[model samples]
Target: MKSIKFTVILIFMMSLTTFHAQEVVVVDSTGVAQENNEVLTTSIVKDTIKVPFKRFKAEGVTAVVGDYVVLDSDIDKSYLELQQQGIGVEDITRCQLLGKLLEDKLYAHHAKQDSIVVSEAEITSQVDQQIQYMVSELGSEDKVAKYYRKDNIAELKTELYTVNRTLKLASEMQRAVIEKVEVTPEETSQFFYSIPEEDRPVFSAEVEVAQIVIEPEVNEEARQGVIERLNSIREDIVDNGSSFATKAVLYSKDGTAQKGGLIEGIQRNSPLAKEFKDQAFSLLEGEVSEPFETEFGFHILTVDKIRGQEVDVRHIILFPELSQDVIDAARAEIDDLREKIVNGEITFEEAAKKYSDETETKNNGGQLVNPVTGDTRFDLTKMDPTLSAQVYNLENGEVSKVYNDRDYTGKSKFKILTVTNKYDEHKADYAKDYEKIKALALKEKQIREIEIWQDKKIKETYVNVNEDYLDCDFSSNWIKK
Candidate 1:
């Protein structure tokens, strides 16, 4: 997994597709910390040292954006981070690197001027999470400290905290700039017409699908067995002094199990299931909860630490098994529901409202909301293969055969799909594709706003690019020559 800082940088980079770190000590690919040299040695894995660290470095300043100093090594560090993320930087020139860093600092600098404050708690939580991830990947806390060449984890955390905080400020500032910018209906129509007839974008076929799902029912025996297993695991950890992390690695079914079930930065208002938050916040540090059930499965959680409204925790989840007979029964149930709709005995919407087991869509007549656009339309070309295969050939109002599928947790279920709406491939139309056109217009407007902001800020702010980068082409006026 990439570090939190890399994730932050990646997000910030995406925001600047039309528009677009720190330093101190250097960590080599051999996992050794060394002093600055005239020429840095190359290490294929050196990029894995993901944190932007600062020790007293003799590296020259590459540029100055507002109050932030961009060091020459900072560009190298960003390159290494990109390399570690498996992103090819062979074509990414040093000037481009400096330009991105300059843009980021300007945002962060002005964010401070505008009194935008990133929560210390949030930064601390992220740093801790990053540490935990590195520890999990590198195999130990001592190894993580060594890799980053820090005296201890505290020093590493402090440095990472500063870097992450600034990156976050840049992100927050970008959001603040464009969050309220929206295109009016007239603007959408104008954007649609502005594109020449020959240059208009052709949209792919799309579908709005609805589903009625029936999850296999686990017997009471299986349910109790899972809960009891979790209880036994909890007992061993509490009474036998066994390692919670080891047990999680051995037995947890959750995706975080490899990280010893560690979940960091879980706040009270975090978008987790209610049952989970209730169980998580109820425990004090080092206190293990008794086995409890959530939408995922039965879990026994241990709170590692708590900071104000946030908690870092670990959990082991055990899902109850469904008997083959029970699975068959669910398949039959959905099949019968499909028949009812097919025979016109009951409408798909009515059957979905009355019988569908999927919570997210059941109340909405089983309409699947496109996770990307928060709308019902899904472009088949961009849809997930499994979903696209199911709905690709279905006509409007046509029902699909009952399909066996597994939810995110790998729990077996059966569902019947129906196409609620279908749009054939067509050229952009003001009346037919208003939403898509509106989105494009709004994005163009946001890009314009950012460009204007960047131009104005560069003039007002103190920016000085080193002479080496004076010839490089940048999107904004960073070189005040």
Candidate 2:
């Protein structure tokens, strides 16, 4: 009876572990145990044991997963339910589990080192927004839940939070890896020239841009009044049974205000503005937070959930009042700058350095990058939304009439923008597409660097293997009998 139970458990464990040999023996020359080595797992236990495939219950593996000690057992129908979730396994034993576990640990480490933190309201806000997008794309909320294999909205949100948190960590890791990497013009040219002509790409003529935006000053009294209004709304929601979502839809003034003030999924450590994010993160689920001020305006929030510190929330935002006079003033100043450029009295780069408020991009001529490919040319849609709509109407190098843009601070400001650059969609040329090819080549080079690093890390990592099937060909270097 003892041997039979042992065999059953062993067989289950082996289904997850990579099987290296076709044949099995009671004992091979290396003294490794095998069951009809030449036979598959099913045939190995032909008559000795029969295990039913059903929903798995872990006998003792919960705590071990948290610590990264992988259980030697099936994950498909049982402990992991990978099959149930349709989560494909890459390397059942060696890579997938360890990669996922490492990503979790690394996110924690970076969050601490960088003081990255999240608030409940922020996550709630994110969840609400994601729900909207998913609803739109899938035709309805119910369909989204069905597509995700969730029984309802709550479960679908739970899965989204889990996926988003991991993705945020991965982004942080990639950013860390890429930040210090530098490419020279020579290297760029070399990479560009190396691509086969037929496979070369035509990069959009995108500009790399930077700006320091400032909002017209708001009266302190008016700002305070807005705060008081938000405080009263929040207090009413908390103390009474009033629905926060209903009020948000009616009163919120942000882009997403119409549909219950939900923004898209906001993961922990998301790169949103500092002040607003802080205010968003401080609330608890289903609880209305106190009115908080960000550059955007007075914000009141209600958190929907908190999953691993990534939250989803709904918020009502009211921007501070900027008089029409201030808007005209900003537009006039930008027009003066454009006139100087049109007259050739001052160059765009000089104007950016001397007067353009956007801090990051002024030093060079105002250029924008395609985030998807880091290219200078962009499709019209890639431009700052208000700017994009306006610029698409003008030919290249034309300056626009005075118009308003909502500054990052959430205050309305006006500007006279130029269709400063343009590119035609054409076949890739080494001269025009060099930078694009260079980046791709550099990424491949970095992957090679990572592999070398991985080889060393795995060798030093303490690993052990089952005493049976040691001679089977394994994918990773760490496993030997």
Model 2 over residues 124-196: C-alpha lDDT tens digits?
Answer: 5455666776677669877766655467778767755643443344345434544566777787777666667
Residue 179's C-alpha lDDT in candidate 1?
90
Full-model lDDT, candidate 1: 0.77
List, in order, the clash count of every candidate structure: 1, 33
lDDT of 1 by residue, 1-481 (tens): 1112232344455333311122122221212355553333222222233223444434687788878988876766766666655577755666666677787788899999999977676666566667766877789978888777778887787777777777778878989988989888888777778788888888998989999989998889899899889989999999999999999999999788888998887888878888889988999899999998887788889999998887889999889977888988888888888888999999999999999989899999999999988889999899999999998888888999988887767898899999999898999887888788788788777767777787888899999888867877666778775
Query: Weakest 10 consecutive residues, lDDT, candidate 1?
Result: 18-27
* TM-score result, candidate 2: 0.49
TM-score of each: 0.77, 0.49
